[model samples]
Target: MSLHKDHVVRWNGISLGLGGGVWGGSVCVRLLGWTQLNDLEIVLLLALFVITPLALPFVFFQNKGPLFSKWTALVVFLQPLAAFLGGASFFLPAGPLAATFAAGWGGFTGLLALLGLVQLCQMRRRHRLSLTELCLAGALLYLPAGGAWMVLACWGLQPLGFGVHTDLLTAVHFHVIPLAALVITGLTGQALHNRPATRRGVCWAAYRIAAIGVLIDPLLVAAGMTGAQITSLPDLDTVPADLLALSLILLTLLGLRFVVPTTVSRVAQVLLTLSYLTVFFTMLVAGTYVLGVTTGAWTITIAQMIAIHGLENALLFGCCGLIGWRLRTGQESQRSRRGEPCAY
Candidate 1:
C-alpha cells in the first residue's frame, strides 16, 4: 500500500466509525420510549457499524482483482447502510416492517457470501487453495448466516426451538466471533504468505489449524443447540462447544506466537499481541462458563457474558487486530517499494 492509499484507508475507517457511533447513539436515545434494546443487541449494532465497515475494506480490497467488482463494491457499501436501516427498524413499533429491513440486511450479506463463493470457485479453477483465501471466504460466507438469524429474530420466528432472544444472540455470535477471528487470522496469514519456503510451510500449517477451528466453532454451536433438543441431553450443548473453544484458544495462541515475532512495528506488535491475548482469556472464560453449565457448579448470566465476551471481542480483539495488521502491512509495503530490505 502506498502512503496515499494508507491515508485513504485510514480516513475511510475513521469516517465509518464516526458514522456508526452517531447512528447508534441517536437510535438508542430517540427510541427509548418505543423499544428498549439489550446490551447484546447494542453490541450487535456496534459490530455491524464499528467493526464490519472497517474490516470489509481491509480484508477484501486487497483481493479486488478476483473477488471484488463494481457491483460487489456496491453490495459492500449497501451492507452497512442496510444494517443501519435494520437497526433503526428495531425502534419501529411494527414487527413486519422491522423484519423487512432486517431481511434486506440479510440479503446484502447473502450477496457477500455469494461473492465469497465465487472467489473460491475462481481459486479452484486456478488450482490455488491457500490458507488466506480460505479465511477470506469463511469470513464473507459467515455473515449471511448471521443475517438470517437476525431476520428470524426480528420476525419473532424461532425455527430451531431456540427463543427469539437466542436467535438474536446467535446473530451476534456469528457476526463477531467467527467473522472477526477469520479476518484477523486471514490478515495474519496474508502477511505470512510471502515468506520463504520453510517459514511459509510453517505459516500454512499454523493457519490451516486455526482457520479450521474458527470455521468449525459456529457449526458446532448450531449442532450443539439442535442436538440438545433432539436427544433431550442438556450436556450436548456445552460439552462440544466448550471443547471447540479450548481448541480454538490453543490454536490461536500458537498462531499468534508464530506471527507476532514477524511484526516489525513495535506498536503493531503490542496491539496484535494484546488482541491475541484478549481472545485467549475471553475464550477461556467462555469455556469455563460452559463447563459450569454442564456440571451445575457455577455460571455467569447471559448479561454478564455479553458485557465481558461481547464487548471485548469487538473492541479489543477485532478492532485492535485489524488496525494492527493494517499498520504492519502498510509499513512493509512502504519499505518494499523503497527497495529496502524488509525485516519481516
Candidate 2:
C-alpha cells in the first residue's frame, strides 16, 4: 500500500474525529458527572461510540470467498448499533431501561458471534483458516461471553466482591475485550491479506496461541467475578493468569514483527506497532495488578489500574489500531482498483 498524501489526510481526519469525540467525552464526563462513570467507564463508552464505527469498514472490505456472506453485513451493522445503544443506556438511571439496553447489546453481540462461527466453519471446510479468520473467530467467541457478563452485572450481580464498581466491570467485559479482538482482527486482515503465502504456518501458530490466551484470560476474569475457586499451581497462585497474559503478549509481539505488512505508511506502521506494545504493557500491568491483589502485597485500587491500563488500551490499541487498519485497507483497495500490485 502506497502512503499517498490523500490517504494519509483521510486517515488523519478519521482519527481526529474519533479522538476528538473521546477527548470531549472524557472532559464532559469529568465536569458534568451526570452519571457515576469513572475514567475507565468514560473511555470505554467513547471507544464503543468511536472505534466500533471504524470497524464497520471491515465488514464490507474484508469479505472474500464463502467465508463471509450478506448476512455478515447485517450482523456487522447491527452490532455497533446495539453497542451504541448500550453505551447510551449508561446515561439512564440504573433501572430496567438500562438493563434492556444491556440485553440488546448482548443479544446483538451473540448474533454476530453466531455468524462468525458459521463463517469460521465454512472457511475450515475450504481449508483456508488464516490468522485473520482466527482473530475473527476469537472475537466472535469472546464478545458474547463479555456481553453475558455485562447483563449479569447490570442485574446487580457481584459474586466476587472485587471492590470495583459492577458497572465498570460490565463495561470492561462488554466493550474493551471485544473491541480489542475486533481491532486485532482488522489489523491482521488489512496487513496480511496481500502478503505472500510464506510464513503462514508461523502466523497461524502465533494466532492460535494468542487467540487461546485472549479467550481464556477473559474467561478466567469471569470465573473470578463469579467467585469460582480457580485451581492454582503448587506455590504459584497467580500462575494461570500470568501465563495467559504472557502468552498473549509474546504472540502479539511475534505477529507484529513477522506478520504485519511492511509496506504500510510510517504513521500506520508506528500506530500498529504501538498498538501491540500497548497491549503488552496493559497485559503486564494487569497481571501484576492481579498478583498484587491476590497476594495483598500491594493495595493498588481498581480505579488506578483502570485509569492507567484501561486508558492506554482504549486509546493506543483499540482506537489507533482501527485507524491503522482503515488506512492500510483503504490504500490496498485503491491499489487493487487501479490494477497495481498491492502490498496486502
Candidate 3:
C-alpha cells in the first residue's frame, strides 16, 4: 500500500499522456465539425478532459498519507467509470437518467476538489502553504462549487429563471476554469521549485492583484448572468489579466536565469520556457479581449476566446508544464539517490 515517488511520477506521466491524447482527439473532432461526432465519441471526448485533470493534484501530493494516497488511487481508477457513465448519459433517452449521470460526475469532481482542499488545509496547518499552494487550493475549491452549479443546470433546475445556459456553463466550468487552475498550479510549482531570484514582495503583490482579478471575474460573470450591471465586468477582468501577465513575465525571466541547460534536456527546457510564455500570452489575449468587449473595439467572439484561452492554453502550456514537472521530478530523484544536493 506504500505509494512510492516513482509510482507517483509514473501516474503523472500517464495522466499527462492521456490528457494530451484527449486534447488531440478534441482537435480532430473540432476540425471534422461537431455534428460529425457520434454520441459516444462526443461523450468520451468530454469525459477525457473532465476526468484526466482530476488526478493531477494526486501527482503532487502523493506522499501525504495513507488515506490520502488511497483516495488518490481510487479517484484515478474511477476516471474511466466516470467517463463512461457521463458520456453514456448524453445518449440516454431518459432525461432523468442523463441527469443522474451528470450528477454522478459532479459528485466525483466534488470529491476531487474536497481532497485537494484537505491537502491544502493540511499544508496550511504545517505552515508550509505558499502562494502557489494557496492559488491551487482556491482553484480546487472552485471545481466542486462550479460542478454543482453545472449539475443543477444539467438537471434543468433553473433557480429564479435566470435563463442560464446549463450546458454552456457546464462546459466552461469543466473545461476552462479547472484547466486554467491546473496550468496555473503547474506554473506555480515550477516557479517555487526553481526558487527564482525575483523580489518576493513584487511576486506577492502581482499574485495578489491577479488573484483578486481571478476571484472577481467569475462574480462578474455571475452578475451578468443575473442581468446585473455587466458594464464594468470587462474592465474589471482586465485588471487581473494585466497583473497576471506582468507576474508571469517576471517569473519567466527568473526561471530562464537559473535554468541549467547542461543538466536538463533540450525538450524539457523548451517546454518549461514555453509553459511560461503560453500563460503570458493567454493573459495578454484575455486582457485584450476584455478591453475589446468593454469598448466595442474588437470583434473577438466567445467561441474564439474559448479556443485560444481554453483549448490552446491547456493543450500547449498545460501539457508542457506537466511534462517539465515530470522531468524535474526525475532529476530531483536522481540527485536524491546520488546523495547530492537537490536544487528544489
Model 1, residue 33: C-alpha shift (Å): 9.0
Residue-level lDDT tens digits of model 2 in 166-246: 546555754666666544743554354445653467665565566666656666665554443334332243455575577
lDDT-best of 1 and 2: 1
Positional deviation of residue 170's Cα in model 2 after best superposition, in angstroms: 4.9
Per-residue lDDT over 1-344 for candidate 3, one digit per residue giving the tens place of the 0 to 100 score: 34564665466556646655654665576567753433323333443454355335533363466667767766665655565555444445435666687677677778777877777868877888655555555555656555555455446566655433534444454434444543454345444444544335665455445544553444444554444323433444455445445555554544455443423556777877787677767767877886787778877876676667655555555556555655765676688799987664
Model 1, 1-344: lDDT tens digits are 23344554565566576657755685667467444776666767776776777677755567656335554556555655676776765665536888898887788788878878887887898898877778778788888878888888888887858888788888988888656787776776665666664244665676666667776777787888788877889887877667556656765665476668888899998988888888888888888788787778997888788877888877788878777877787798899999987765
> Runs in model 2 with CA error above 4 Å?
1-23, 65-69, 127-131, 159-167, 182-186, 189-208, 224-240, 259-261, 294-296
RMSD of each: 3.7, 5.8, 4.7
lDDT, residue 289, candidate 2? 85
Off by over 4 Å in 3: 1-63, 89-95, 152-175, 182-190, 193-263, 341-344
TM-score of model 2 (CA atoms) = 0.77
What TM-score, computed on C-alpha atoms, does each candidate reach? 0.87, 0.77, 0.73
Error of 3 at 213 (Å): 5.3
